[model samples]
Target: MRRRTLIRGAAAVVLVPAGLAAATSAAASPRQKSAQADDLVGVDVSNYQVGFDYARAANEGLDFVVAKAGGCQLSEGPYTSDSYAGHVDGARAAGLRVGHYFLTGDFLSPREAADYFVDNLHDYRSGDVLALDVEVLDDSTRLWNDAEVSTWFNRVRERVGAYVPWFYISTSALRSADWSRTIASGARLWAASWGANDGSYPGPPDLGGSYPDWAAHQYSSMGSVAGTSPIDLDLARPWAFDVSGPTDPPGGLPKTSAEQDGVPGPTMWKRTQNWLRIQSGYTGPIDGVPGPNTYAALQRNMAGNWGYTGPIDGNPGPMTWSAVQRLAAQHGYTGPIDGVMGPNSWRGFSRFINADAWD
Candidate 1:
């Protein structure tokens, strides 16, 4: 639904290092120099970018690609981008780290829009970056509120386990709304600000103190890549495309008061309640009681990845424990995933939830 208004001359092809980061420029200022040295070169494409040659772009030193997944269009309502799958597949095939973004519109509620976005995502893997693009609504007078935007991010995080999604917005449009809640939701900034529009890499954007630092900067929409001309170019930090697994808590997993008897007690439940409160949308008191509220939030968080497709009824059935085991497998649970919770499973789950962050 968004279109580039300006088309500049072909960008000067800048060679990137074998690694993700690029070399610094001596002619630039101090802030610009730092951005150039640490930022990775990447491009974002939608259906408008036709027949994009991903391999050629990668050969030209591009490190990543963020393709448009789906969003609500002003005319068509909620719709998925037809080219989303091809862009993701081609970018991955070309050895480029891939990401996906969903454009938000005024048609649907933020929760519904986020659910649609996650449902329409193609070939999603852990560590793949996700983003919510919010810009000015040309056709509608209503702008997205802070709580609405936060709801979108929180809903997406509920489905996808770890990692925060990037929040994309231009400097002017961001000023039009209060984003305190969205910021508190842990969504990183993908600041968009084009200065001069001369196909030159702009320095660190002036976010007007809205964010401490940006995860990615969309500096030029008219920049040229090897295989694609007049494309949206971005400079992103290494954390923007980090594919490493979730970072473990400091000093490793803490000891839980639960006995090694395979049954979770009050202490473990309390910690889990706190985790669900922070990560998922659990608003219940942390009374260490494993009630329906606790299990319901856990089910929402596991629905996307752990294969818990049932309702959030707060009832932990065999399917619920099975999904919990699937999650525990990543944290050192080697036992059979037979929907059975045993001592080993408890230990592994404790390894995951027994973090100081939760406590």
Candidate 2:
């Protein structure tokens, strides 16, 4: 971090109209001015392990980057990290415009989705764009139908407000839904048509080339830029902005514990507990406790990705414990789920909710 240099208000007033004063101000870094550049070319790096190496890309004529922020209905574990914080800082250092993408989740209510987005967006500021990756599930996953999905997208736009350039990724799932008109009406489109990259994606062969309305085409899935891995699209179109204001909605979450003193809350916790119990066929008080029955429900849920290796019994050995821990951590729960609680776990949960809980 560098020391702050103050520019007097008199000088700021005189330099407002000509633009040279602000351009020449010691306070404004080269990166801040770079936001005014034309034709923004960048990529959407959403994978966690394969991080953003902006300096290398900038050397390769990269002008901007849309980093991945969250995914799948408020599922946690950021694709970006503190290293990425400095990575974007380096991009700014290299005079590149930067933006972000939020992978939309299916099971989340609109409000929950908004909360997830706001939590991750605290780092972004003026002139940045906000994008929504609208392709998560395939033909399975009954979380949301096409129409319901569109509604969720609109809810996101409403919550995010108009300061940022709100955009959408049109994946195969989006194409199948035939909700193009519905979605495009509100958001700038980032169409995904894999011709030379991820084999033949469905629909028109030249969707990207022909779709004049799209802000950018996710031209490839296995993109191999210099310092990055073979990841998804790593490019975007420039000139997508008309204003240079805050890219996120104003007024973030209350910072202190006392700020969330009293309020009626959603039944998501109860709903989640019940859903898990029935899936495991366990009889319990739907208490928010992560008891054996709750763990049973989680095991069944984790059969695919979260790492549940054994039967749906109440015991959480190494495998089951690992899976439970992974799922909990992904959803922004940093506390240990070793069927135990302590001060650290309580602090983690408190931070996770960022709001007061009713006793």
Which model scores highest in TM-score?
1
TM-scores for all candidates: the values are 0.59, 0.46
Task: Give the Å shift of residue 200 in candidate 2.
Answer: 14
Provide the lowest-lDDT 10-residue window in model 2: 1-10
Please list the residue runs of candidate 1 whose C-alpha ends up more than 4 Å from where it truly belongs after superposition: 4-36, 137-140, 242-359
Q: Give the per-residue lDDT of model 1 (tens digit) for 39-120.
A: 6778899776757888888877788889988676454477777778999999999998888998777778899998998998
Q: What C-alpha lDDT do the candidate models reach, one value each?
A: 0.69, 0.45
RMSD of 1: 15.7
